[model samples]
Target: MAKYKVTMLKMGTLNGEKSNMTMGRNFGITTEIPMFSVAVEGNGHKIILDTGIKSLEWARVNLGEMYVIEQEEDETMEGALAHIGWKPEDVDIVINTHLHYDHCGSNHLFKNAKFYVQRAEWEAAFNPVENQQCFYFEELFGWSAVRYTSWKFLDGEAEILPGIKLIPFGGHSVGSQGVFIDTEDGVVCFAADTIGVLENLYENCLPNIMTNVEDGFKTFEIVRNNADFVIPGHDPVMKKYQTTDFPKVDKIR
Candidate 1:
């Protein structure tokens, strides 16, 4: 059995309404959420969980002024990889929690890697409802289909590798999945968009953005019960848990 080291790569930040992140609370309040791409490295494998958005302009134009993006010129996808001693081509696998633009925007960068996404997510990207269009960019998906070599569509919970599992739980988006990693400390769950902040999970709140509110609550409970600790999708609070050995990297266990 191999124990993988998980690191959070901060791609950038986005400012949005607090209510948008935590359902039905903090209506007028605004908050900045950190955008990240988690790297699970070990056993000679470099698997990335969601390839964080690359275009600030596109995000602004699509998401609107309510979502303010703050990304430095140097904060490119390749640059984030290099921070942890990796290159774009060094990635072996790419797992998208869902097909949201922010999560899958940089898929083109990892052209050599195999992408693992939920079957429901793949279908939703192609035939998105009106509300989903803001988050799911058709052009980005088209680019990925033409650029990436392979894609593995999962139906439910399955172990993609020895100690890593992909658990599907729809909430933030239909067919959204969470990554579970067995580590030295315990099992760590990347809650993905199901819980974007610690406040959401701890306070038992759902994000305003969800395809199914009932599933969102259920997904939150599932994540809380299953993992030792969770990595939220867009929380800057994760920075406090950074590993001393790796700069800009947070350890799950």
Candidate 2:
């Protein structure tokens, strides 16, 4: 097995109602959530989990009203990558856990990388119904088409590299998938929106934003059973494990 080093890249942050993240629980509380793009290095490959939101304007135009995104001038996907001594072109693979605007917004930056996404996610991105419309942005996909030409649409579980896998579980999005990476400590699962915050897993609460509640719960169960360390999609608690200051990256275990 190939052991990899995982780094969580802080993209930016957002303020939203706790209910939005914890589902039916904590209805009135509001909190700030940290956005991240996990970088997995090993097996002679540079693979990124998801490209965080592109820019403030992009967020404002697409997701601001819903998520209330707040980004500083320097908090950019490119800047984050640079902090890790990497450029977009240097990325070998870009794995999208889902196609929500926040998750794939900066995908256009990785022009030279092969994008791996779920087949259902690709379909939904192109043909989102009313319930899924708010999450998928046509503009982002249009921009991505122009920059990223390589795409590998997957159906279910797949081994992208030795000790690296993609497990699809349609919950948060019809095509939401989690990336499982083999690491020194054990397996680290980037559960993505399947488990949006630490509380979701610890408290056994599902996220409010779910396409399929049953799938969401199942996804959480799968992650808990398989992963040694799980990384949630939007949790500031992740900052506690950060090992690098420049990129604000966190180690999973």
Candidate 3:
């Protein structure tokens, strides 16, 4: 069995509404959520989960002033990978938890990697639900130089490698998936937007951004049942586990 070392890469930050994350809660409040890309390295393979956001200027112009995004000098996707002794082309597989702009923005960087996305998600990226339409940007994943040629779509839950499982549990999007990587610490779930923050799993709340609220709640139970440790999609607290070590459950808070 290959014991992978999972590292959370902080690519940038977004200033968003609190209710946008907690769903129906924290309505008049705003919060800063860190954007991260998870790196799973070991067993002669390198994999990335969710590729982080695009340039700051692109976000401001395309997403408007409401979605203020910022990326520091060291927070670029290239910088994040370099911090772990990796470059984009060195990655073998890129799994997109969902097709949101913030999650797949750097998909183009991995020119030599195969990009995996759920079949439903690939379709939804082209024709998302009314509310989610604005969040999907085809250029980020489809119109890139690598384009659809290097893209692969999964029908549902599948394993990309021996110790890496792609669990498609949709709610956050039409085809949202989570990456479960077997680490020395146990199965660590990179619980995408379905589990936006640790509080959502601990408090049994749903994120405001979702295609189906009911499915979002069900995905929470999936995480509780399967994950020994969890890395949330947009939580600042995950920054503590940015190292190359396999993080244990107790270390997450």
Q: Write down the RMSD of all candidates, one decimal each.
A: 3.8, 4.0, 2.5
* Regions of candidate 1 where Cα sits further than 4 Å from its true position: 60-64, 143-149, 244-253
TM-scores of the models, in the given order?
0.90, 0.90, 0.94
Instruction: List candidate 2 segments past 4 Å from native.
Output: 143-149, 240-253
| Candidate 3 C-alpha lDDT tens digits along 1-253 | 9889888888789988988889779998779988888888899999999988877877878998777787887688888788778988899999999989889988888988999989998888899889998998888877653566788889988978889988888689999998898988789998878878877877777888878888887887777677788888888777733753333333222
List, residue by residue over 71-189, the lDDT tens digit for candidate 1: 86445678777767898888989999998888888888786798998898988888888887778776766653435348888989989999999998878988899998876766788
lDDT by residue for model 2 over 1-253, one digit each (tens)? 8998888888889888888888778888878888888888898999988887878887786664777877654457788777788888899899999888788888888878889999888888888778878888766656534344588889899998999999997678888899988888778888888788877777778888888888987887778777778888898877722533312112322
Clash count for candidate 2 is 0
Candidate 2 accuracy as TM-score: 0.90
Please identify model 3 stretches exceeding 4 Å from their true place.
244-253
Angstrom error of the Cα, residue 238, model 3: value is 1.2
Consecutive 10-residue window with the lowest summed lDDT within model 2: 244-253
